[model samples]
Target: MGDTHKDLIFLIPLPGGRVARVPIDVLEHYVDPSARISHGGEAEEEDVTAHSMSVDPRTGASIWHTDWELGQCDYTDENGFPQSAYAWHRHPLGNEYTEIYQK
Candidate 1:
């Protein structure tokens, strides 16, 4: 119920057509999640406004429902600077059914 306790998670897009969900605690020391998110390169980037993700931490069901203008993207760059790959999903702890992006 408080923002102070909120946490962040990262979703990595895989070339094989599956998303990898990694907890922020496991990546914060090496990766920046924000740097990997963006509205595509369209003249008018499609805004990802509604997202519904539920993870039963105990069961580890990291599935999500996101409403956005879909596009293809690469998750990591050649330098691995956390590219905004079209396959990642972020889970901001405690912000249930949160809105992740605004076009």
Candidate 2:
């Protein structure tokens, strides 16, 4: 089956045992800015959100998550070397916000 379209909300538990209510399909934009989990002593920025989690806070379990995927033949270059994932990223050009990674 394809992606389902429905009005839904997810209740995610947060720090201090707080629970966050987030709308389906748009949780990333609504992440709790202050939430953080130990990732090499740094925050996971986009993954460790109150609305969405890459890990299970209780067990420290995690799964791979990436916003983009490579297309079939888009994996390598003419040299047969793996393409850099960073090359696919485009910074937010034009002044919409002072922060470059706002989105």
Candidate 3:
């Protein structure tokens, strides 16, 4: 029997206000994780907000893509009551592709 895996999908924005539903497996095949900027801590996983880079089939230029990260509330409300909590905080990871391209 073949191995079974969960389907992880990401909605990526395109050039003309269009979006594409891409699979995690496809992104992994094209993008190199080490090539991109690092974020978060040891407890944080690259498991969220998938980002990747790939070549445009038509233009033959490299393009960086990303999905939305899950948000959470970690602070207390104005009433001084605990609102909610997040497992971890998200950090800004700049575009490695753009930096390289601009050079």
List ranges where model 3 is wrong by over 4 Å.
1-5, 37-103
Which candidate has the top score in TM-score? 3
**Structural similarity to truth (TM-score) of each candidate:** 0.27, 0.23, 0.31
* lDDT assessment of candidate 1: 0.42
Q: Between candidates 1 and 2, which one is better according to TM-score?
A: 1
- Residue pairs with backbone atoms closer than 3 Å in model 1 (clashes): 74-85
Cα lDDT of model 3 by residue, 1-103, tens digit: 2344437777975443468998778887888543432233442363344333333445645543333222342334467665443322222243431111110
Candidate 2: residue 30 Cα off by (Å): 7.9
Please give, for residues 1-103, the per-residue lDDT of candidate 1 as tens digits.
2344236556865545667887667776786332323234442244343333333325544434343323433234456464443443443343433222322
- Residue range 1-103, candidate 2, lDDT tens digits: 2455545777864434467887677876667654333222344554543221245455565532232211111134457665432222121232111111112
Candidate 3 residue 101 C-alpha distance from true site, Å: 13
lDDT accuracy of residue 84 in candidate 1: 46
- Report, for all candidates in order, the number of backbone clashes: 1, 0, 0
Model with the higher lDDT, candidate 1 or 2: 1
Candidate 2 C-alpha error for residue 34, in Å:
22
Worst 10 residues of 2 by lDDT: 94-103
